[model samples]
Target chain A: MDSHSHPAPTADVATVAARWSKKAVVVAGVGAVLAVVGGLSAAKDGGFGKQFGFSYLQAFMFFLSLCLGGLFLTVVHHLFDAAWSVPVRRLNEHLACLAPVMFVLFIPILILAKQIYPWMQIADPASDAALHAKSPLFTPGGWYGVSILLFVLWTFVSFQLRRNSLNQDKDGAAIHTQNMRVHAAYGIFIFALGLTFAAILWMKGLEHQWFSTMYGVYYFAGSVWTTLATLYVISLALKKAGPLALVMQRNQFHDIAKLFYAFTVFYAYIHFSQYFIIWNGGMPEETFYYVQREQGSWWGIGMLIVFGHFLIPFLAFARIDAKLNIAVAIPVCVWAWMMHYCDMSFNVMPILRPKGFELTITDLGCWLFIGGVVAIAWLRSLASHPVYPLKDPRLGEALGIHFHDEGDAGHAPAKASK
Target chain B: MADSNIDYTVKLGLLAEYATPAELMQAAEKFREAGYRRWDVYSPFPIHGMDDAMGLGNSKVGWFTFCCGASGYTLGMIMIWWMNAHDYAIGVGGKPLFSPIFSFPVAYECTILLGAFGSLGGMFILNKLPRHYNPLFKVERFSRATHDGFFLFVETSDPKYSDIETRKLLESTGTRQIEEVRD
Candidate 1:
């Protein structure tokens, strides 16, 4: 094996983090103002409180997806003991740390739960057996309690995982790597539960009459795609700053892009699979959801998602070069984010604004509100240690990787003696 | 051409062996930039950047797959409509004879089936696989390509290929061995 490249020395982690923390503060400040503005207007506009409730849910879910997906990626990084992603793993760790902030964010949804969830407002369970059957878990109290538990679970595990990683930055002990890997292996199971339960409880619970086991996976797929797209932008920004440009290689981008592509197809596969099965059953209850979506202006948005969310980005990022090329990748990432926002809106907004489409001030405010808080927390957490793991055993492996299969021969060692 | 083909079992190409994939990759870049076509690189594993260096473009199979899927979907739609409206004229619980929502399931399946086959068939035809014979297989050392070897084969047919010039280029690239392959 070739012992070729090693990571270049870098400025202190404290210094590099200051650059991002300022941006985080600004984003948080803006988010705080938006939350206040959106909150006050919703209170005053009593007629549109229901819309605000759902819009808030939509924005909240979108931001939650990013953090949940970040946790999932961190687990995968450790589970596979991935070497290529070491430089960027800190970004994921910080996002995963946003689990606490997400916990606090859930309170808003609880306050708006009665308006958003149909089952919560049901007069009597005796009249509705389906709602009654799932009442043990989906009850308002049960829903809030179990969801809080899920977030608590997520925050605890995410915090522990980040601590283990930060500790490794201090000491390159195999034990630290080993402990985190084991923790990740099991943490994934808990994270899956959190994601699955959160998806079913919060988003799917919007229409209690409608149920699909694949709903959780749909949320998961969205999380992974959005998480990766966000990471790509962060990595691009870091590289542009001239620090990570020397330490990190383009190979990481290509690898992450490959993963982004897989999740994109996985999301479509899950989306289509649920739709295909439900449509084939031809049952009135399940089919009604599709009918509702396909009939109105929602139909237009649905078609847009099919093309924008899946087709265009799928085709654009299909190539190896496209994933590795920063210019092409950024536009595709932005498009995917737009489509992700559209996907969440399609899920949430149809309950109120089914007429066609409308982007209210509250919707814009809520999005900025959730995004700003998480951005602030995740960015501040970056300074916990070095931008890259200072003592990671696989740092060399990351530094030496070739981004593409046909990478320049100049990068490889003198020759393969084998 | 016939006389030439009849002589000496037919001259296939010049087969050059490089000690490592890196060397073969370098030779590939040199030949590609020198504008030689009708040549290929073989190694135990793929070398990064070989496709771009060889001036290869994206595969056209995606287009084939797309065409097949679109046609399959259209065909499914027509079948469902014709059977319900004309041939059988059966009522699906009084639903419209051509309800597109109900037809989506079958249309989706058909699209996937035909698209998958299109890609498989397109790849096989484009690559000319299941080929019965190639003169390069006559070389005993070539078999190591699957295990541990790197090869760059420049066909005699390439316009840039000349025995003396090609031989010198391969030697300059530090090829471990070079030989003329017979058909």
Candidate 2:
């Protein structure tokens, strides 16, 4: 029997690190130039400056949500002892490292909360009226503090676990496995709590008075959808760059593609269900959110997502050929990323523009700035280690398996050795 | 070793080949009833409950899927709360921050998303899919079983298996051809 062992060459790691660093520098430079241009333009229009700041806050929160979601996926994979994700788990873990960066990035939102959130402008008595009339559930300070604590805790735990796993590679100790299992068990609990608080602070609070029990799940669906799409793009880029060329195969890509499809559908279902239920109930306050989203420019974006996010991708990925074919999968992955941005934009813009609003230089700038920072953080993490988990026990198992057969019968049956 | 047409025939050793799907299923049931543990059934198409007929326990996949679905729901709810209630606290149309009606879509989506993930991930883990190489694949004739044949093999590792006795037992069961499986 073959030992099924293989090592990732050091030259491969260096090449990957160098390529990612170059890409990071280029993206950062472009984003910096755009931010200055957008800031100057906003300065020319006084009211637009305020909108720029608010949009920046919205973008920051969206990025933070993506990091938190990545953390949740990593911990869940650990808890389940998942093998299929072995090829890409490192990328997800590295993305989680951005949580600390997000913590700092979120400061902009915290400073300008009053300007963006209406609840900040109303005094205690007026707030009390709003709260009383609304549902005595308003607690801005408590909500803020809990969100900070959750981000801190998740960042701390995820970094520690990932660090330990990488260290295990050098030490080759059985104790690392034991430690990981323990971390995984507790990590899942924190993930649940942290993600819940994250959704409340980010999306649900967009409309302080408008409450949705399903808001967290809705945000979660978007999070997973975006994160999975992001992972697919990153993995594809890495493969093209040639460092992870050997480790990632068509089978791994197939797995990631499947996840992207599943979550895309999941996100659409939640989006529609929220609308359907609110429209059916006919409540003025709850239904108004949808009314804003379904009309004007926002309406057009929603329609785009309906067909672009769900319908288009659903048809494209329905067949086994498309899911496994990079030619087809890459475009769908890019579309998923675009739809995620549109979805987040639709959620954020409608809250600020009661009378409806137009897209500004700031909206695009905010996305670029935060996206630039996220790209930088991800690159820095990737540079710090090999693109693949060089010492993971399952690396060999993943390499040896072939998930699909050449013909239309799909998965082939296992053969018995003579 | 001598030329008794059956002796030199190479005791394929307890290998039982079935001409029809029903016969294969019946042999599986009998082996299961006889308390045989280390045996497997092969067919041209998936034989439903062959695992159970062989007395295998229910798969652990359900537990994994349930956990994933439950967590997905919980995660969805929390995400909505964090975004709407905690972070910005903006009031859109005077709706409460924790409205169940609004949050249901996200929660439901998470459940389905996680459930599907659990099913796919669980199937891979339980059945050990994507395995390109297995000891069983070394059997030349075994390759055709997946194409258009039915077979049942009681591994020599089984406690009840013996060269002579097992062969006689398989002969009694009306197998026309038998083949030895070596590890």
**What TM-score do all the candidates reach, one by one?**
0.84, 0.67
Q: Quick one: best TM-score, which candidate?
A: 1
- Candidate 1 lDDT over residue span A1-418, tens digit each: 1223444334544566677777767766776566556656766544445756777888899999888988999999998888888878878888888888988887878777887788888888767877887878877778978988998888888888878877887667778888888889889999998899998888888778897889999999988999999988888777777656655566778778989999888888788788878876879888877787876788988898877888887889977768877789999898888889989988887777657666776777778778877776776666555676767787656765353344442343222100
lDDT per residue as tens, model 2, A1-418 = 0123445444665667667667767766776576557767766554544566667866776676678667867777778777667778778888887888888777767776666666656677353554555433346676567768877888888887788778766755657656766887898778776776676666666677676777777877878877887787778878778766666766677777788788878888887777777765788878777887877678888788788878898778866557867788788877877777777777777876655545566766677778877877887777767676666666545553322222211111111000
User: What TM-score does candidate 2 get on C-alpha atoms?
Assistant: 0.67
Candidate 1: which pairs clash? Answer: A251-A403, A405-B47, A405-B48, A406-B48, A406-B49, A406-B50, A407-B48, A407-B49
DockQ of each: 0.25, 0.03
Give each candidate's interface RMSD in Å.
Answer: 8.3, 12.5
What is the Å distance of residue A50 in model 1 from its true position? 5.1
On the 0 to 100 scale, the lDDT of residue A358 in model 1 is 65
